[model samples]
Target: MTVALMWEARAVEGRGEELLAWAKARVLEREPERRETFRAPQDRVLVITWWDAEYDAKLPELPEPGDELVTRTVHRWRFEAA
Candidate 1:
């Protein structure tokens, strides 16, 4: 099975670039099959990682950034390939 984990966060005002850099620098304990990062107009950053694992299996995920880096809590989701 294949699982995709999505992590999204909104950085503080005018800090989108810094947030994107931070996200890109993060290293998972175990690398995923594939990973990608994206940014939007609202200073939001999105990261998606695809893994070879069962839906309910334990997996490594990006941790929340420091409180000063974001405006609110991060959001995450998981999906299984059809």
Candidate 2:
């Protein structure tokens, strides 16, 4: 039974680009089979990442200390084929 890991995060003002870059790189290295990854900043945009058919995955690297790239929230959802 394979699963998908859904990662959604929002960064504080001004730090969006760096965080987004980190997310893109991390997914490539950590979960090469990711189905999707997106980052956009509007009034409060979201960075959405999808890891496809995952059995287990290492934790995504955390932002460095003093980065202040807080995670307003995080979510995980199970995927079921239709």
Candidate 3:
């Protein structure tokens, strides 16, 4: 089964594009089965990465974008394919 990792960040004010670009660049280094990025109205960026591995397996994760770039702390969630 594939493991799906969800990463989310809410950029401060007008930094949504910057945050999106950062995520895209980073995720590209570790190619996954599937990856998708989304932006919301309130500068929220969401990235979903799907991998063929266990949830407990060690995997590269999105790092925090720091308080200067984001309004709230980054969020990460892991799930196994149903």
Best by TM-score: 1
Ranking by TM-score: 1, 3, 2
Selected candidate, larger TM-score, 1 vs 3: 1
Candidate 1, residue 70: Cα displacement in angstroms equals: 0.3
lDDT of each: 0.98, 0.51, 0.87
Per-model TM-score on C-alpha atoms: 0.98, 0.54, 0.89
lDDT of 1 at 30: 98
lDDT of each residue in 23-70, candidate 2, tens digit only: 655533464344566666531323334444445645343233233664
Q: For model 1, how does the per-residue alpha-carbon lDDT over 27-72 read when each residue is reduced to its tens digit?
A: 9999999999999998999999999999999999999999999999
lDDT of 3 at 35: 88
Q: Which ranges in model 2 have alpha carbons more than 4 Å from their true place?
A: 27-32, 43-67
Ranking by lDDT: 1, 3, 2
TM-score of 1: 0.98
The sequence of per-residue lDDT tens digits that candidate 3 reaches over residues 1-82 is 7999899999989998998888777844567898898988998999999999877988778889878889988999999988
Query: Global lDDT for candidate 3?
Result: 0.87
Q: Could you tell me which 10 consecutive residues in candidate 2 have the lowest summed lDDT?
A: 58-67
